[model samples]
Target chain A: MSIGIDELEDLAVGAAFLGTGGGGDPYIGRLIATKAIQDCGEPTVLDLDQVKDDDFVVTVAGYGAPTVQIEKLIGEGELEKALAKLEQHLKKKVTAIIPAEIGGSNSLVPIALASRCKLPVINADGMGRAFPELPMNVFSFNGISASPMIVTDEHCNTAIVETASDRTAEKITRAIAIELGLRVFIGCYPMTGRMVRECAIEGTLSQAIAIGRSIRQRPPGSCAIESLMHCLSTIYPDRESRVLFTGKIVDVQRDTADGFSKGSFRIEAFGSGQSAELIFQNEFLRVCVEDKLVAVVPDLICVVDEETASPITTGALRYGQRVKVIGIEAPPQLCSEQALTYVGPECFGMDFPYKSIATLEAEAADKAPKSATAV
Target chain B: MSIGIDELEDLAVGAAFLGTGGGGDPYIGRLIATKAIQDCGEPTVLDLDQVKDDDFVVTVAGYGAPTVQIEKLIGEGELEKALAKLEQHLKKKVTAIIPAEIGGSNSLVPIALASRCKLPVINADGMGRAFPELPMNVFSFNGISASPMIVTDEHCNTAIVETASDRTAEKITRAIAIELGLRVFIGCYPMTGRMVRECAIEGTLSQAIAIGRSIRQRPPGSCAIESLMHCLSTIYPDRESRVLFTGKIVDVQRDTADGFSKGSFRIEAFGSGQSAELIFQNEFLRVCVEDKLVAVVPDLICVVDEETASPITTGALRYGQRVKVIGIEAPPQLCSEQALTYVGPECFGMDFPYKSIATLEAEAADKAPKSATAV
Candidate 1:
């Protein structure tokens, strides 16, 4: 299927929502992807099942602190050049490009490269949502290595890292990212088509598009947010997706260090004393109301503009802005015990035990007053 | 000339003295070189003039904090593997190996790899004495690029860094070195034999061997330290090498950070109230006696056993130890206006202008009491 400008816009919107306040700014990515499509024809989007068993697939993404992107935008040609370097190192042509993670900008960056290179982009992605680190995905949990990875910066500097473990690869790449000014394009996690079929999150690109379509094409009399929530619940009944809170951002404390944008923000419910706090490392990992976690990683926690329902990424969060927080269950593969080790609360330095969004929400409901609090 | 275990040992000792208390521990490197010679054949040491201009010459050395080597040893196979990676990247065979810097362990590491790989070892080097960082070498000062550089750890992990400037290359390599636990082998400064002859400090290896010989093959009736000093003065008459001071170490302070061993030490005259202090960053760059400047980089400052002339490294310095400090004029190449910008006192954060050891020594002599005090 050829993805046109309309599909690209919808994909960006849905990716921003799914990004849960990390990834990168959608506007910048949409512009770049849009330009690529116009200049070099629409990108071919292929389903996971369409790729042959023997085909080679490579995941492409930007790796660095998102805060750095606010001032230093992703420039043209870095992604294409980095992918070319990876191809040269492997001595093989890539069968298709796959997003390492689905995010506002990240989901489309690969597609832009695919358009220019005239390669197909797989509908699948490693992480259904954006993640801060490379190894926190199903591919790593399923024993796939992240090595033989190439990282490149705008200055044309390239570093090829090959190591034994995904953890080491992440470390080496992060070190390079810090030295290279915290913005880099990585061509990594080289895998076979069979591996992608077996381990990747399927149809993420299409799912993002569907979620975005609901927000854009709400019924004339119906509220856009209601339509979006309805669309999300209908699409992810198993995920138990829902709006958890609507409030004004009260405070935020963020700082970039060691190539990571890490901090937390507080929000107070409208006309209520109740509040929620969300702590993040690139992507929002934990959201709590009254010291009780309503959502936690690898579950999804997202912030969207209250009235318009457009996604607001972690980097764009501002004090006194009205927003709504949403929570959705993680994919089944990522919810496994083995997968949790890579994205669990403990993995992010939180000592709390793992609790599904369902269990946590039900517990919070049980503690609230009969009328149900706004937060 | 075939470098036997005896010559290797002498080279290590002399390199340690020239290491200016940085480089790495000589005993560790000497043992490794000795074993390599026994396993393979003797390393063929060739003069700088022996090779043709088109021959491919690569410098091989370890890059990281020398203090780290004291606890974690330099293992086997890393250099050979890293060198092979570099060769594969360039798609050409390395015709010869040269020391990136001449120091206790660094000067001998390339020779050891040369013995095993059956490649001739260049008698010359980039830095006649060691400095903490890569760009501080004459090779970089002479417009040599340090990129297309490959760094490898004992874990078999390799990183290839390519950039426009040697300074950026050093920063990237150092970042990786910190992540790799501060002990890494690097195959960098890829240049032709013509570049080596044009820019390299010629005969550094042979000069180190000679300095070691004076300490070992001293005239029966003469003091070993005296013989060593006489040998140094003869070898670098333009440098005017001499013993600068003799005293007990009264105080010392050091710490390892960002892949460098940096600190200062104080020495008190045996019976007099006068004292001297030397500051270093992996290498001793400056020394002051009676609050008067005595030596500074790009000059050479060394610490040796007061009676035996065995070089003592910065990592091995201890309070209350008796020692003699030696200072030698820097090579003419490094003393030039452009070269000083790379290794001058200001490069290491010293604000004082760089003054030659000859001038500083003459000034100190003029201020001294007639008949001269021991300090």
Candidate 2:
């Protein structure tokens, strides 16, 4: 299937929903991808089954502070430059492009470059949802090397990192990004089609498009929260999707530290004394109501505009904005023991044990407090 | 010519003096070079005149914080691994290895690697005296690109930086160094033999060896300060060398901040009402008597043990130690208008105009009270 300019808009909306307040703002990415599709022809996007076993696949993503992305926008051709450099280092032609994460800017970066380079993009991604760290991707958790990664900036400066560990590569890449204007294009995880099929979160691109289309097709006067939850449930039948809270943003405390936008926000329920708080480092990692855990990653904690169902990124969050908090079960692959070791709440220095959204909700219902179980 | 174990010691001693308190303590480098020579046979040492114009040359040095180098020593074969990677990138045999800076550890790093890699050691360096930043090197000032620079650490991780400017390269390399244990082996400024001959500070290896030999040849009870002065004058006849002050270190205030050891030391004249203070960042940059600027970079301010004339790096400074402050004129190349734009005192944030050591001493002589002239 070809991804045209119209498809890019849908992809952006879907990516923002999946981003869960990370992955960076997608507005610029959508514009860039739209322009790229217009300048070049629509890019071919191949299903996982269509990829040859021997084909070489690479993942492309934007790495930097989301706050910085709003102002220091990437110029056209930057992603292509990064991909070209990676191909040169690998000494092989890249048969296809893939998103490192299915969120915000990262989701569209691959399509933008693939269109310009006339390469097909794989209809899959390393992360089913947005993640703040490189290692949080399935490719890294499944033993794919992040090495021979090429990072390029708008100024045409490039750096190739070959590290012994994925974590080290992330560290070095983040440091370089900070040095090069706080944002860079990264092409990494060069895997064979077989490896991609084995480890990738398959069909995330189509799923995102479906989600975007569903949200857009909602009728006027329909409850956005109910429509989005129904859309998510229809698309991901095996996973639980629910609106965890509905409130107005009361407070947002943020600081850009250690190359990450880290902060917490509080939401106060309308006509009720109840309030919820979400803490994040790039992506929303945890949400609690009255100091009791309601949802935690790798489960999704999505904040969206109540009226329009448009996702709001962490960088875009502000006080007094009415929003709905939605929680979706993460893919089983992400919740695996090995994956949780790196992506779990412990990784973020939280002492609380990880429990699924369903389990937390079940316990809340069993407690026999009507107001507490209202979510 | 070949550099043996004996020559390695001399090189280390001389390099320490030339380090002006920055290149990190050479004790470990000397030990490593000595062991490498014993195992691999002495490496060939080639003079600039001996190199053919077409021969490929690369500079190798250790980039890191001096305080860290004392404890987190490199494992064997690290430098060789870095050079091998660089050669692989350049797709050509490195005819000779040169020091990026003629500083304590950096000066010997090339020789140590050359001994094992079977490459000739070039009798030259990019920096005649160690400076804090990579752009302060003569090669950079003379328009050599510091691109495709490879940085490797003990863990075998390597990063290749191709930048549009040398300053960017330095910023990225330094950032990577911080990520990779605050110390790394950097192979940069790949050039032809002709480029080295045109831009490199030639004969620095031989000059260091000569200085080392002279310091060693001093009689046990002879006046070390006077003898060292005579040795320097005899060696660098065109340059001015003098003891700037003779006093006891009264105070030392230092802090390791931003990957640099920065602070100042105060010295009180022996049995007199006189004192001087020297400020440094890795390398000593300025010296003042009662807040009056006496000597400043790109000139050299060296502090050595009063009794033995052993050079003390900024990291090893302590209070109440008897010491002598010596000033030497920087090479004319480094003092050139273009070179001074980045390496001069003002570049270090000092507002004062740069004046050569000779000029500073001349002004002091003209304004001298009888006691002040004693220096």
Candidate 3:
């Protein structure tokens, strides 16, 4: 429940740990958060209990091609462009700006805005981990629409859409990004602080900090992976984590379409006796063993560099790079028919049956789910 | 100024002629318009001058992937869904619905709703010919913004984006598409009859009908291109047209990102000792001769099957398919730095100097501008 200034760094690192590969580079995110904290002083962490249901809250994040942001470096005040419009659309004073998720650069984007906007940071996110779609947010799962959404790009171009359905808003956002040549910034999902508190994955920022701190404090020869495993065990005790593979990337192919990075990579065993190929659209959604489907979409598949333990994005996945692939059980909420139908195996074009991440983890865990129903 | 029911068919053909090969398939568009007319009777066509500036006119068209609409056909009540949101956003009665552009499909989309919604159809459009960006409408060039836009997909999903800027509205729309898995549907833009009249390419529906009729009524033994060229001469003697080359498609590559099918193609000359490479994003903008730039961006570069005379998209361009390359002048407004800069050669990664389609035509006519200072 408590997140300190120094812990922000740890949280980012840990969020990167949960990125499941392909959230985008976290360097800009870390630097931005660090700068915000140093300049604005530490941000006060607000607990869920403090937020009244009627208190206005806004969720902010960057929306665009990760590859483009790395080069263009969204101009200063770009996030503000969308925020300004959001304020106009809501016609209410915003009490806080919450990070939509904890992953890659997005983990830092909210920090950048909060430092400049003088808003408190919510210690929760819509997704417990990360997802490619806006509607996939836990807030949406909890019955909150992402409408009255404000989106913008660094060029100061902003849009505020009040859609009858969140899906329409999603289409509009995708189209505008395409029209802008595919890179944009966005502040969306304006809700009451109470709605955020009730719907969000609570205490995630604090959890991220703990996981990050544990990894950073670990001594040499102590596996960073083991530290993460230990930290997550405390927070997600019912769930299990498994080190899927340790290998060197052999090939990486990527395509950026409609603000999503769709691609795949092949990895050869470095020391282990196994090799694998991973496929994804924005996240490492599926993994295979020698062309045979092993673990599929909606199951968490993260690849971190073996040495630094940094998560690798699908776009950044390169040949000749050493990585440790990690698999973790997805939250039970993500296993609902609606959730699986969207981010599951069928959504990504696999004919295979839906299998829970717990099932995959069982192959590596000393003990596994009894019936494979635990996602 | 004079347009008949048969003229509408010709205009549809001509609009497709000017579409430069990247509007959604016109067949479905024609069918939709035809069916709407059959069911609801003819739409009342209003001229620009007939519409007052303050008149509530909304430009409507579909937003999302064309591929999806082709499969599902648009839902019957979807337009109503979009209109409901639009009416709320405008907070006024929509007196008329106008075509934003005379593209293959959208040119007729409004027709489907004309009688059902009891809204008059304006003969004008934002773009006389289709251009990808929403703001590319002449209305925008004339100081009208595309904000307060209404977008609806086939799923009865509707959204209203009322932003201070048109570009911001576009960004929101793009984000929505990205989130919705690239669903396609209708959208209304720049909600003022005056702006609609000024911005909507005037009499575009009439143009489409004329062109369609001309192509269908062409004399036998006259190929599609020759017949169309004759039609062009008759319709627009002020704008010169040239059959640049007759060749066969050798290669085609497409990248559908950001709602635009952008990329390039190569064609082998049939009898001429030359080959041409063309690049396009939404519309064919640049063409090169053996890697040396021949036609710059901002000018129209179109490819039609030599015998069939059907326009081919860069995505549909295939190897060994016989094609005829044609060049035409763009509107003077599109030739300006403000317009050309958006779709120019540099935007497409070409290093050629921007030459107006008029200037290019002038060169072919021995009337090329002799001095830079002279307009």
Candidate 4:
């Protein structure tokens, strides 16, 4: 399969919806990928089964404050430059590219770079959804080294980090990204095709495109919520998807600290006089209704425009915006005991235990007819 | 010549004196070098004239807050680990190691690593005396690239920085050092023996040892200052050395900020009613007597114990301690127009123009009979 210029819009929309209000805004990414495809032809999307065991595959993404990406536009050829540097360091040609995360701008980053470099992009990603830190990805969770990672800026300055552990790599890379104007392109997790097949979240790029196409086919204000939820459930049969709340944003408190956008938002039910709160650090980590924990990571909590069905990132959220909150169960691999220990709510300093969206919904049903249940 | 365990003490003392209150304390470095030499025979010290043009040489130094060096001691084999990583990156064997700066701990770092790795220590350094920032070194001022620089911490984490400009390399490296507990070991400025001979301050290591021997040979408190000055003048004929003041420290205001010990010290003359002030950032940068500029960077301003002629670093300074202030002319290359722009008073944010110590001394002589002229 090849992703041509015509499909970029759908990819961006799907990626944005999957971003869970993190991964940064995808509009610019869409434009960049579109232009790259137009200039260099469509990028080939290689299925996992097609990858040779010995082929070299690398994940590429932009890391920094999403807010900065809006104003400090990336220069042309930045991604190519970063990928070239990484190839030089490894002294091996890259056979394929993959997104570190299949969310927002990160999803399009690989596609753009692939078109420019004429390398196929693997139809999978390290993270099924957006994550703020480097170690939160599936590859790192599976013990794949993030070392020999290359971080490059628009100015062409490059730094290659080789750390003993993934946590150390994250610390050093994050610090360097912050130092380099809070935005840097990173080429990391250079693994063989066999490792990619074993560690990656399979078919995420195609899943995102399918999800976007499903949402786009529905009328803007007519049963859009139901249609979107139906598409998610059909695409991820094992994962639960449902609307958590429909309300108007009442208040928002956010601040960029420690190289992350950290804060919370409150949403009031349109006519019920009830409110829900969502806490976040780069991505929405937890959602609560009337002080009751309804959802937490690694479950996805996405905020979207109630009327237009367009996903809104945390950086783009504003008070008084009417929105629909939704939660989707994470992939089974991500919720396993070992993976949860690293990406669970506790990792973000939350004291509560992890609970699936399905469990939370069942508990809400048990308290039906009450003034305000969790869901 | 060889530097056995017997010579480590003298090397530390001389290096500390040359540190000008920066480059960290050398006591730990001496111990490390002594142990390494004791374990693996004496390390060879190669003269610049003996180096072949094609020989690969690298400067080794510890960069971070001097205060941290005292409390968070380095683990054994840390320097060797960093050197091994750099060699792996360059894909070639390093023929010899040189000190990045002939100051405090940095001066002995090469000796310690060289002894453990069985490589010769070059009798030269990038900076004749320590300066806080990386670009202040003669290698950078002379247009040598600081690229492919390796930064390693106690945890065995390493990062290799390659940048278009030396300033960018320093900025990124400094930020990483701050992130890694305010100290990191750096192997940078990989150059050929020919480049080292052309840009390095040759024989600095031996000069430091001779200076240490001169001070060590002096009786407890008899004219040690004059003897030390004589040794310095004889070693650096183009440079002038003189006593600027002999006084008790009345006040010392120091704080560690931006990974540097920055502050000022006030010295009141023992018998006269005159006082002088010294401002420093890692190293003593400027001095004024009665509010008149006496000396400024890139000239050397050193503070030492008034009685023992022992160099006292900024981190060890205490109020009410009697000290001797001495000034030595910087090497002519360092004081040239090109170098001064990066290491001069202006670079330190001082508004005054740079004046040679010779010129300042002549002005002070013409103002004799005045109550308080700049020394």
Candidate 5:
């Protein structure tokens, strides 16, 4: 389906809602996407099955510390700069653009690229949630390389990297980010539609839109606990979604180093007379409720306002604000030992082993395992 | 004098010593400079007035937070990235290179550029003593524009900017740095030898080398207090210099924002039952001794280790370091209202009016002023 002018905001909002709070802010992304869509005209989304086996699809996103972007706004035409160069290199019309990850600002980045290039945006993403490193994506876990990658920044600085190994891409990307200045607009991960379709998380855009709409139309005075659980139930039916303690943010300790937002937050529990803390490297990976480890790495921990049910982007969450913390099961694909190696609690300085969100919840329940639910 | 392999180490050492702790660590910078010298042959210094009026010149330096550079070392040839692009853009062979600033890593940045381009280096700079902002430089203050600048990062992101205003150039350059990821290499300030002669600080390189050598050759048990005063007295025989206090740092606070280091520091007085505090934005502008304002801005308030005679760059002066703080009369040119308006104590966040460093020193002497008596 092709996007219309009015649908841009909806799509951008949806994308940001699903960003799970680690993407850079979506305002710049939205403006650029809107402008690109206006310039190239509204584009359509191509189905994975419709794309040929060899069709080349490139994933694009901004790389660098998010803190810098707020101080120094991006220059014009940087996104299209790398895109134009990539197209020139390929000498082929890009059939579609795909979101590499669903986090704060990047969720909308691919949509913007697709709208600007007048190409369809694939319905899938490499990560079901946000991650700090490049190779942590599902595609990389599936043995797909991140190289032959063309990365660029707003200054029109570009690099065509052909790495010896996919792991090298992370180092190269980090170095490039450091050299470029810690924040850059980048385009990478060129893959065929078939490879992407098999590796990517499908229908994330629709999922994000639905989540955004749910929050937007949330009933007044209704606890986000029920609405979010209802939404999760729509996505995962068997397990009963539990409402974690409601609390006010007491502190948000953040340090942007080595191209990642490495920090944690503490929340003083209000009604429950308990405190909650979450630790993260790019995305919320662990949550501790009342000094008990309620959730661990490989689980998806999200924080939002209790009243509004609106998702809080990681960077936007600050102290003295009331929020409702929620935890959900990460897709089984991300629970592997390899996946845990890069994004697990250990990677975030947690002195604990990886525990699936489902397993953690079931352990908390102290009951028989329920039927497996498909997402 | 040409920089040969024989003197590159000495030069690099001298450059780092002169950097006064702010240009970043000289390890990687020395490597790059040495490699460039080895690769492109020795670079010779050219006197500005000696060049023809039509001779092309450019300034080269790294543009970004120094912290970013330390975390991710610049890639090979990163310094030449912007220079190469600028050379291509102008279609004119750059005959010489000059340093835009002479503090921190910037003091040595030109060595790499000049060696790589096989260009003669100019012995002058925009600032005899470094000021944080681009417009505060002598070149900019003297009506030389910073536009037509080319900025790039190791990622090969290149930006060619020409602005009507120098402030716009600063903004754009900073934005591009942010885009390149916060660490960028820049080649800028394209000007003719005539402009260079008119606006540049002549013999700054020689000055730094002399100052560095003197600091290094201090006699045993000789305080930096005597050595620095001797050096400055020799350099500026016409100017007055006074040691305000000899003490160790007790408290230091700083914020690196808007491309300037703005902060304050306090120290416990060496002998008296008192303390001293100084406030600054880029340069040491104010000093208060025992809650009494002792010195003000448009003056030079340099702090150095009492024993080592090593000058302390503002950002590098930390707690527990014994230092001898000196107050020197600024040059007549720098004592003007224009200079004070740009760098006075008020500009940094003090509530006092400008006071001449000489007059302040006279008041502090509590004795008869010496008249043209060389120490």
Candidate 6:
């Protein structure tokens, strides 16, 4: 299946939801990706099973803090140059572009590069949800090296990181991005088609597009939030979703430091004696109600505008804005004992242990009074 | 002339004197360079006129704070790897190695690599004396791009910086060096034989070796310092050398910041109660006696032990140590108006005006009382 320019908005919206309140605002990405399609024709997106074992897959996305990203959007030829450099280093043609993470701008960057290069995009991604760091992905969890990676600034100043571990690669690339003003494009994690099938979280592109469509459908009398939850369960029966908080943002704090947007925000329930707080580092890492952890990393914590049900990235959150926070369970692979070591609550330095959104919500329901509700 | 295992000491000693008060300690470099010559046999040395117009000349050196470099030495294979990566990027064979700067470690790195790769080392250098930053080189002074350069750590985590201005290349590499523990090897300033012949400071290697020998000769009835100054005049009548002060180090301060050993040290004359202050970032930038400027950057401000007459690097300075501060005029090209724009005192953020070492010494001589001797 290929993504036409018309469906780009739907994809962006869905990607924003899965971005977990990070991945940057997708409006600019949508514009660039749409223009790329018009200039070079819609790109073909391939399913994981469609690629042969010998095919070479490359990952492309922006690497930097989300706050800095929106201020200085990707410039012309940055993507083309990075792709060319990556191919030159690999000494072979890239078969397709895979979104390193299925989140707003990260997803769109690959599609845009794909259209410009006349290449296909893999339907799956390294992480089903967005992560702030490079190694916080399934590819790293699967022991893939992130080297031989090509990074490019808007002015075409490029560097090729070769033969570094994923951890050192992250530090090197992050320091570079910070030195280059906190935003640069990277084409990393060169993998085989077989590795893609074995390590990637499948159907993320399609799933993101469908999630975008469900929120926009807005059936009469059916709350968009309720419909979005229904859509999640409909797509993945094993996964669960819940409305963690419905409130107005009271205090939102952010500081761009060490190549990340770090801070937390407080939310007060509308016309109710309940409140919640969400902590984030580029992506929302944890959501807590009355100091009790409700949803943590490796799970989605999507913040949406209350009336329009439009996804709001972490950078777009504002004080006094009415919003709904949704917690969706991650795929089983991301929550496994092995995977948790890389993306779990502890990996993010949270004091508490990792708990499934479903389990946390069930525990809350059991503790609450029969007729009363608590945030 | 090819440098054999025997002349390595003379070369290091001379390079250290030319390095001013920085360029790191040469003890370790001497040890490693001696082993390289023994392992690979003697390497050929090429004069400026030796290389053809089409020959490719690559510059190699270590880049970081001098204080950090000595603590964690360069491991085996680091040089070989950087050279291989650089050559691969050029897609052409490097005909010879050129010292980017003729200073302690910087000068020896080339000889070691030349032996390892069976290549000749150019007898000239980018800077006749070491300057802290990349843009301070004559290659950059001649408008050569510092890109297509390869940098590597001891662990072989390599990155190739290509297509950036020398200034930007410095920032990128510096940030990476800091992130990688403040020391890394770089192969940069890829130039043609024509460029090297036109832009390089010629014969600095042979001069360094001669200076090294003059200091070691220590002729009886005449001070070694006196003999060293005589050697300087004999080699280049166009240049002048003066002992700025003979003192005991009173206060030494240093802070490794922004990938540089930055600080100022004060020295007091042995019995005259006179004092001098030398300010440095990596190499000595300025020397002042009684708060009056005596010498500024783009000139050599070498510090040596009073007893041994051996050059002491900036990192080796200690309180209460008796030393002789010598000021030597830089090569003619380095003092030219065009060259000063890149390495003048103003470039180091000092407010003093540019004056030759001879001019500063003459001014100090005119200011002192007829029978009074001051530091």
By lDDT, the best candidate is 1
- Candidate 6 per-residue lDDT over residues B117-231, each given as its tens digit: 9999999998898889987888887888888999899999899987658888888888888888888899998889999999899999999999998898767888888888888
lDDT of 2: 0.87
Cα displacement (angstroms), candidate 5, residue A299, comes to: 4.0
Point out the higher-scoring one by DockQ: 4 or 5.
Answer: 4
Residue pairs clashing, model 2: none
Give one digit per residue, the lDDT tens place, for model 5 in B167-237: 66676566545545556666778889888887677776776666665676666777545765687678768
DockQ values of all predictions? 0.85, 0.89, 0.23, 0.72, 0.04, 0.76
Please, what's the RMSD in Å of model 2?
Answer: 1.9
List model 3 lDDT by residue over A1-375, tens digit each: 534467667877777767665444577777777776777766666777777778788888766666665676667767765687677656677878788876777777787777767777787787767777677677666667787777676666655666656656666667766666566676778788778867777777777777777778766678877776777688888766677678898888888875687788889996656789888777788877756455665667778878767667666778899988887777766677766765667766788767766664445454445564565
lDDT of 5 by residue, A127-228 (tens): 766666787788888777776566666656565554545666676567656656677766667788788878787766666666665666656766555765
Q: Clashing residue pairs, candidate 4?
A: none
lDDT of 6 at B319: 96
Tell me the tens digit of each residue's lDDT in model 2 across A1-375. 667887777788889899889887889889888888889878898898888899999998888889888888887577877887778778899999989998888898888888899999999998899998888888988999988899889998989999999999999999999899788888899999999989898899888887777677776777766677788988889998899999999999999888888999999999988999999999999999988899999998899998889899999999999999999998988888899987888888898767889999888789867785675
The per-candidate TM-score of the B chain, in the order shown, comes to 0.96, 0.96, 0.86, 0.96, 0.85, 0.96
Give a tens-digit lDDT track for model 3, residues B1-375.
533345456655566666776556566767777766667677777777788788887777765555444555767777767776667655678888787766666777777677567667787776666666666666666667676676656665555555556555655665665455555554556466655655455665665666566567778777676777887677667666678778888788877687666777888886766888887766677776776555665556677778877766554667889988877766565666776555556755666768765565456556445574354
Q: After TM-score superposition, what is the CA distance of residue A271 in candidate 5 from its true location, in Å?
A: 13
Listed for every candidate in order, the interface RMSD values in angstroms are 0.8, 0.7, 4.8, 1.2, 9.4, 1.3
Docking quality category of candidate 3 according to DockQ thresholds: incorrect
lDDT of 2 by residue, B145-183 (tens): 998899989998999899999999989998998898878
Clash number for every model? 1, 0, 53, 0, 20, 0
Candidate 4: regions farther than 4 A off: A219-222, A363-375, B219-221, B271-274, B361-375
Instruction: Compare candidates 3 and 4 on TM-score and give the better one.
Output: 4
